[model samples]
Target: MSITAQLRDSVRLPGGDALVNGFAFESRGDGPRRALLESGHELEVHDLVEVFAGERAPTAVFPLPWPGWGRGVHSVSPDGSFAVFSGQRAVRAVSVGGETLWEYRHGCWGPEIGHAHTGDEQEVCRGLEHGSCRVSDDGRLVWAHVVVEPEDQDWQECWVVLDARDGRELARLPLDSAASGSHHLSHPDGIHMGLCIGMGQDGILLHWARWDGAKLTSWDLNETMDRILTDVHTGLPGFLTVEHYGADLRLHALDGAVLAEEAPEPADDEDPPCWDYGCGFVDADTVIASTVESDEDPDRARHWLLDARTLEIRGAVAYPTGPVDSCVRPLGDGTWLTYDDTSETLNRWIEAAS
Candidate 1:
């Protein structure tokens, strides 16, 4: 598949802020448009034209009272008629043009700042309210993962899922218990929402929850962290691609079933390389991963292509020069969307000749 490049020129903010909370693309005029929100409470809308042309200045800016917490326009309707943002009190829905269409709030702040208390004191959460809102593939329903604190001020962690149309708690899941701390990674498939729950030092867990219009049915993973990574099918029903990684450093299925667990050759210490972030599949048989290598000479990040089914090294290439940040996603075709530190923006590149 071919790819197009885009950049936001003048909207660049100084570094040292938190990582971007979230970003999304929506239809604007004739092509896809993009919006980026910085951790400093600034929002920028990039028209497809300006983005492709790498325009420096944004069309408009909104200074939200987000307290420098996570900010983003998480979901956009399929027809591009509406969008949703993660706000302080509620999930705000806006027209495609960024006008407020509606606001729905289910929970509120307690007496103390950065604290949320439930009606029965059964659950409580601290810090800024962290949650996500994503439109379903059909664009008819929106799923919101609302982060909340446990009321007893214990170490327990929990999140509430709300119905986006009207604020309603569809389901509540215990993310972490007093003895465990958990974090969620959203890997939403068509009708099933898959989340990766890391159980602190204990390891990671994968759960696949089915979202019926009215409620949710979840299945606990019988597998552990070492057997990480799962094959995910996004657009097509039976087309499977691995989208996440867990413990074994090998490939696994969505239910935590071991697909392959062979270990690769150990990385050479003199090679100045170390695995950094996560690994993503390039196809059913291939995976692309990033790493940082530093020794007596210099330290840098690079991308590695490996055989997902064989655990063999396919290729390794020097990452483009710039900051250390990098994100790689493959298109349905053989090409990939590679974002590096160069433009401080995303760019596209075809896989090198093999």
Candidate 2:
């Protein structure tokens, strides 16, 4: 099968040497579509988050207080009023005017013995780098994974929910596995969130949680599949996309039941099996799976559209340009977005009508 995507829009970024290394798009409750752009060196450099809409200049810019790479996660609130930065030792909320609204600190992320200067903050870590965080749907709570050392126990981490208005801890749940770090996926329901913990060779762990205002409940799906979760389709509740040792893809329910699985179909005997970490639902019933170059095809990447309900390959998607990097992101509206690092531009793609 073959799919074709047209270029819906394209926007060139600001800043000469600045490239959009990471970004998050928040469509404010059907209002304007805003984006948070994180740009700088991959690690150890000045960084900034520029909030913009369409092709307009950034409406707001928040210069991060620290100068490290993915050592932490940062995001702009849905309404574009505030920004949150979760770092190795602190989680801080900053107002539009650059005032620190509130901050929550935790254990370090690297070795306890060494310290490095970040130009702004003293960088230190004991174990893994800090993970990611997401603002709740209503923008009233923040779900974050923070490093913690329990009494008489080895250093570890916990998933903590914070009162977004004041940065107060609302609830905390200890994670049992040895995680290099983790990332969070927020659900539309506001009360539900998914946490994916990467544990190096120990494998990946997926934790699904639901907060009922009074308490937090979670289920570890790793006890069942033990695969690295590549993406979560929040638009399709209970649906998750995961990769098995980079060899195959599986669609699973949040409750750990497998919905469907697929492996690459080699075109010939010498074609190496190819799969990518990038996969997500294009809509409730359609998923976009990307593939890297195989031994037989090194110059081109492939994008496969799958039947979300059955995980069957519906067709290969053709973009106006060619295959993007493996990090293609879904726009949740039957469209997807990709960044061209060389050109420093963002491209949006939509499936052409059948």
Best by lDDT: 2
**Residue range 1-354, candidate 1, lDDT tens digits:** 211222212233323011221233332122233444443545554443464465656555544334444532355555556656655346677664556666655443213555444554223334333445665556555655443545665333344555655545667676542212222333435566554443345554555566676666776663434222233423222212232332124554555555554332345655434443344455555665554322233344455666666556666644334333454543323333444344455554445443
Query: In model 2, which runs have C-alpha deviations exceeding 4 angstroms?
Result: 14-34, 40-54, 68-70, 114-121, 124-128, 230-235, 293-298, 320-326
TM-score, candidate 1, is: 0.63
Which pairs of residues clash in candidate 2, taking residues 3 or more apart in a chain or in different chains? 109-125, 109-126, 110-125, 110-126, 111-125
How much does each candidate deviate from the true structure in C-alpha RMSD?
A: 7.1, 4.4
Error of 1 at 296 (Å): 9.2
| TM-score of each candidate structure, all chains considered together | 0.63, 0.84
Candidate 1 lDDT score relative to the true structure: 0.45
